[model samples]
Target: RFGDKFIRVSFSIPTPEVERFVDAFPKVMAEL
Candidate 1:
């Protein structure tokens, strides 16, 4: 349903929220 290597990310939240996502993203990917 998606194109190659497409990962959706949004920056529409507060700075703290975005920072949290950036911090947690790599760990999430490691489990995937």
Candidate 2:
């Protein structure tokens, strides 16, 4: 797990990027 790194970075990034990442997050987890 990413611990607080993901949580902290998500808030700093653009909303669009975060949304895009959100969609891809599950896909990444599945691959892992």
Candidate 3:
């Protein structure tokens, strides 16, 4: 039988990493 067999889950970054990403986002977008 066809089945998922296992469950999947999503993960997120911590607050500090997110903040650093946000701060550098503009520079990242600019390069692209």
Best by TM-score: 2
lDDT of 1 by residue, 1-32 (tens): 33232233344567797788779988998999
Q: Scored by CA lDDT, what does every candidate get? A: 0.66, 0.95, 0.57
Whose TM-score is higher: candidate 1's or candidate 3's? 1
Q: Higher TM-score: candidate 2 or 3? A: 2
Worst 10 residues of 1 by lDDT: 1-10
TM-score of 3: 0.57
Q: Which ten residues in a row have the lowest lDDT in candidate 2?
A: 1-10
Residue range 1-32, candidate 3, lDDT tens digits: 21232111112666687677768878988999
How far is 5's C-alpha from truth in model 2 (Å)?
Answer: 0.7
Error of 1 at 21 (Å): 0.7
RMSD to the native, candidate 3? 9.8
TM-score of each: 0.63, 0.83, 0.57
Which residue pairs come into collision in candidate 3? none
Rank the candidate models, highest TM-score first.
2, 1, 3
